[model samples]
Target: MALGHRARAVIGSIAAAAALGALLTGCSTSSDEPAEAAEQAVEVDPALRAMLPGELLAESTRITVGTESGYPPFEYTNEAGRIVGFEIDLFDAASDRLGLKYTFHDMLFDSLLGELYASNVDVIAAAMSDTAERQADYDFVDYYNDSDAIMVPAGNPEGIKNLKDLCGRTVAVLTGSTQEEALAGLNAAECQDKPVEVVQFDTDADALAHVQEGKADAELTQWSTGAYNAKQVGSGDIFEVANTEIINPTPLGFVFLKGDVELVRAYQAAVQSIIDDGTYAEILKKHDLSAGAIEKATINNQPQG
Candidate 1:
């Protein structure tokens, strides 16, 4: 399963859902309003204020980052129980560039944002897609552009070559992911008058396992996740990448609390500096993920719907 293929399979069904309710949401209210309204609305404690951006990185020597640590080559714990991956490296590089100390906390991918809102962490360096809907809840620093792909058993035994081919086949996806959103629409249409089932898992590994066990016909996921799984499975011939599509090619970036403009600026500067100095490319290559890197962009302050 090539990275592109797995992303396609997972995204195919997800695109169907978007077609049902896919409308771009905006994030701007007024330029004069404080950018921290969302965090203030949540009433984060005073003690946590120091942890927010612009208060001085020295005040808190260690910053905490949250990630799922299950999506390999992006964020995953190694045999030593230390989180390591492309996102992890990016954070490490940023921390080093900023002379800031940090720690990594592994949690559910969907829960990472909630933890940030709760003031549990200072940043989220997971491979989070920067969508307008997500921007409404958090600030993002765009760093990469990722597209969806599909993954199937080698030779695509079911001839599951594309989303249209999945009309009567089972598909696996991670629960709570945008990929699931795509699948919802496909399932409604493709399985509307049939027995097709869309199975969901907490992680890509679990979803891929279901496919390996013959419990499902294929798994859909991010390009990187699909590629990593294919490599781990150790048989390019055993799995096939099919129908690559940019169904959800979103800017991937590090997430921060809504009002942390200073921290976001610092991260943006660090990311840009890395990109300029060639350090960013080195990190991506180190992880065999050079193709995923993208140019740095100003933080999009508008809300996403």
Candidate 2:
């Protein structure tokens, strides 16, 4: 991606609502209890230490993880200015399992891959989808599954009930996202009369702002993110996820530099250890993201077409 072309910046309008509760459709996290029963810590396996790369084991005590702290419930800064979310919790469990320490750096989502390639960070934990295209540059330890949804202003004043409703209308989407590609496909297939006017923004927060301010008719984004953003921006008073067929189901993962096979293997093993020990499920449950939890800690094995 071009460093010069950044997505619209995430405005500070909704920064106060970063800690919105989970109320995503088709899922419920409000009633779920915390993953831990008490103050128990995840057990680390000494044997796993051998799996780490020589460079990692010999040089670094703490791994620096890159993340876009705008997406709530997955990874976002809380009121305390600390990044906290489901992804953070899962990383904590994985780190505990491998006896590793980590520090997270918040930056624009699109810049993460470049940062990783430049060795500015060790891994990316930005809820990034693991696609074949990305696998060409980096390896991913797949962790969760998610799909897309179209979100519009609350009450859906424009009556955008589904994807078809976006035909001939302007739609806001995050720049460089699969959502834009999906909408392009939709326009090519269905919007022959009037193609979808895709308004790309630098961040989900900005894309969300576009729709909320009536600059765009709706925004197409991940289902959970749409729901989370809706709850956060206006506490569900400004936007709501439209009733649309879930589209483009994708696997999200923690990304490592390509050819870093040993590091990938180490992280994969640590993730699997969490999954096997039930800490993975517990973390998802606590975040109300149990629905997106993967059954296994697979490598970049997801279908890319």
Candidate 3:
């Protein structure tokens, strides 16, 4: 919770973003174009491919994935409207180990689960964490280790540095994120006398906008994402990550439907293969996220038990 590792990751991210933004200034791409995962020379693992369901293989095993690209450094649309991030890189590695093809569909984070339930997609690889509550409807292929964080305007203007400082202040959060649930709980239990105002939005973009516009005092999101947005907006001029203990350090994974045991097994083995071969590590380092890399591939990762 000290954020010793995550904070470093954020700083590295800002340096990279600043460089990228400079070169792409004045250029634009149609937002309608979805960013595809990076195509790399990943050798296919025949053994893992055989573990996949026969029905899945029948269609050439091109897995359809749902994601919320509004979150940066992990999964977000770049200046070219191309989907690029560590999550995409991880999936690219997993697909290689599994010898499969994958596609990404960007949508509201709240609707990702629904799309999976409706059979519109085969997986959700949006840096989603595997929680006990989520386990009721989904299984997961754990890929990254991360935590929650808060973002406030630069220069410590409001002096909201820690969890306690959030009391009586308005904090914007994504509508269905763990941060929203966690912050509300904090309000009810710890800030009863002066509860924090929890403003909800369906998109990370909207939640971030609320804080930048001065309508909210702060925004709660994934630590790396908060850090990414801070440097991304104005090259470190817009916001700064609060100096608080990392909030909910947890595993972020590829969410799968509960009944797809075969598909789940395929991914678990594929993920382990990448971890063993160093492909996973390389991607993490490329995105300045090596600090959150997990040493093992796990399924349905819930730290509680």
Candidate 4:
């Protein structure tokens, strides 16, 4: 199979580690917390509110959301030490539209699914993609899409501009991620003569550090995230996204455990309501993530179909 085709087959694995590193950093609640609040409250849609399950609105009128806050432009700690990002903004907008209150908890990314399954969280608003495999275990309210890309040191020291360039070179990837699989497949099929050397790290920061310290020639992650990290943590001078096409672009969304059709419907309607009212676009623009915007909210998005 061609690189893109092979990439599509492995995209499911990609979502598994999208924010592992970010999640590990923990939540940031600054003194200026209220300042990080959403700029505007959305007008609630009565119909959407009516669709919410009684349990969701019963006791507190709040949806407890689990988020991995270390990823930027989506969910990350700002200079002011408060949790803020386009995803948080979107959550605030959706809650307003649905006339519901929400409280976010910061935790490890790997714990998100377990928490959801245990009813510890009503929703997961992390930048999690709704891959088909995950859909089997949960329902999704799809919002935006993104892709995995490469990041290399500044000045393109290794002259690594594309996936092919990773051949015979040490490449850093998140441990247990599909990105690792994709690179391995590419090496086995296309770079047999000079197989890509793969190094797996527990977190994105560690993987990135490997690349920065010259331990690895390239690192793979969400393209937007790579750019954000390169700028925010690396000072924009230490790294640059390699000029290569993404192996596969994936849809990112909010997750709820399986069998919550009512809650799922409520969230989907609330999200679509924001899209229609232009609130979604404004939030994305505010975070410079307008490119990640999706036109309509979807349930259980399975692009591989």
Candidate 5:
């Protein structure tokens, strides 16, 4: 469905309202409940907590985390060249709780996975969606839930509203992302007879740039990514994100070497502790991102490959 200008404004207002409400509520559970009840609220496997550090270091130590610091609101280097965002802060909270230290290495989003697989970095916190295929290569600590969306220049000059609308148009997507997979499926199903051109970029910003310059008809990226990008570069009016169903909803998580059960458990415990408290929600709110928070089911489900 084509969203009218008024409709887009309303969606923007709703997104802002939800973000503010989440910030005000934070992550605090019901206060009337006993501490024991809150503690028992989420049953984290004891095996995960068993991986705690033997002795907390007096001085700060460092754990290397790989991320493409260009994907703002997720992980990105600000104007000062400092890496900051939801994922960075989440990991900082995790490190603080674990009494460990960390440093972030920014690289191409796609390369972060390879760096983890090669043991080049201890972990990856790059807003990476955890999928069965990816789980086969690395362990994950589920955190954010995300879906795909389409970004078109303001006014949607081309009248693009959804995937089906792009029957013969060119679409830009980041390499090595679920968006790519989804676009491939869409093309195969709807445009196979007259394939839609898919242009892959090394970074999401690059892909969005393609749309901005009219090189691409639409840019398919994570919903949050598109929202943040449009807000930042499109002045909240330069680009419009289409709420179309594309890929299956997936949870974004941190990736570590496969079989590192010990580390995964430790991270999981840290994440749970943050969630049980209010730190996790606070971080999300700070970034205007709360819809991305993991739901109850996602937290309980065991990681599967």
Candidate 6:
């Protein structure tokens, strides 16, 4: 981990979404619901607190968490450089349920798993997909549904509407992301002769910049991220999601090391606690991201017993 290159962002304002909600995918929020609901105090359960690892049981021990920002409506840095988003809010709510304290460490998306494996971060809060490839080595408490979208310049000059449209066209992707993997698979299986030219960047902002500057014809990212950028950046004149349809909506979660059963189960309970208390729904509703809301918390898609 590059200690010198990271910013420790104390994620705040989980419910301060009036401005944030306006820059979304046109989902409606309850104007009548006061922000006070989000600010409501969480009563920590002693049973759940007792389930935490001994090292984490201390009041002073802060769980080091890694997150890759720049994907808005999920995780991103504000103008003041504070990390705030739906994922941060969801996890914060979960932390409160478990009576745990944790801080978010923002870094390159590529370095998040590395930092987690190196013990520099105890968990990853980024909206990471719980793919079979990753589940082989990590246990993830599934929290939300995630899908990808194809974002192109406004008016979509390239006429890119779907994956087949990317043949021979340039697409910018965040390195180590599912989007990058999708491009690789496309090149190998479908676009061999005129392979889609893939440009990799370290963050979502950089990848989107490739399209904003006309370097790449399109950018592949989370559906919510693409939608938010389409609406917010350049006052809604910069980008547009070519594919309005959802693709491969998979469960995403807070990632933990494989065999870390206690930690994984503890979080599963925490997430369930929030779901039961309505905080989970409120967070998603505030962000207009209820499309990805889950009914129950799971680990790798299996209901926790």
Task: State the lDDT of candidate 1 residue by residue for 1-305, as single tens digits.
Answer: 01111110111133422332312111111112222111111221233333334334343345656677778888776665556677777766665566555555556666677767766566777788777878887889887777777889877778776676766778898877877877777767665766347898877778888888898898878888777767777765556666566556777889887776667767777767677778788778877888877665557633323
Per-residue accuracy of model 3 over 111-189 as CA lDDT, tens digit each: 7787677565577878787788888988898988888878888886998878778999999999888888889889888
How well does candidate 2 score on lDDT at residue 257?
Answer: 83
Q: Give the candidates in order of TM-score, highest first.
A: 6, 3, 2, 4, 5, 1
For all predicted structures, in order, the TM-scores are 0.76, 0.82, 0.84, 0.81, 0.78, 0.86
* Candidate with maximal TM-score: 6
- The digit string of per-residue lDDT tens for model 6 on 1-305 reads 12212322222333422322322222221112221235656678889888876656777556667787777888876665567788878877788778877666667788778766655567888889899998887789999988999999899887888887898999999999988898899999889999999999988998999898889999889898888888999889878999866776788999987766777888999999888888888888988889888989999888867
Off by over 4 Å in 1: 1-54, 188-196, 301-305
Query: Is 3 or 6 the stronger prediction by lDDT?
Result: 6
Runs of candidate 6 exceeding 4 Å displacement = 1-37
Per-model lDDT: 0.65, 0.73, 0.74, 0.73, 0.68, 0.77
For model 4, residues 98-176, the per-residue Cα lDDT tens digits are 7777666677665777767766566788787677777888888899988887889888977887788888999998764
| Tens digit per residue, CA lDDT, model 2, 1-305 | 11111211111223311222221111111102243221346877877767875444542355667777778778776665666788878877777677776666666666778777766567888788888888998899998999888989898888888777899899999876778888988998988788899998877888988987889999998888887777767566888988667678889899988876767788898988888887787777777777787778889964322
Residues 1-305, candidate 5: write the lDDT tens digits.
01111111111123422432311211111112222111123333344434654322334334456677667788766565566678877777665566555555566777777666655556788888888888887778888888777899888888777777877898999998988888888888998877778999988888988988899999988888888887887358878886556446788888877765555667887887778677788788888889878643132247433
Worst 10 residues of 4 by lDDT: 1-10
lDDT score, candidate 6, position 183: 89
Candidate 2 ranges with C-alpha deviation above 4 Å: 1-40, 302-305
Least well predicted 10-residue stretch by lDDT in candidate 2: 23-32
TM-score, candidate 3, is 0.84
Residue 30, model 2, lDDT: 14
C-alpha displacement of 260 in model 3, angstroms? Answer: 0.8
Score residue 249 of candidate 1 by CA lDDT. 74
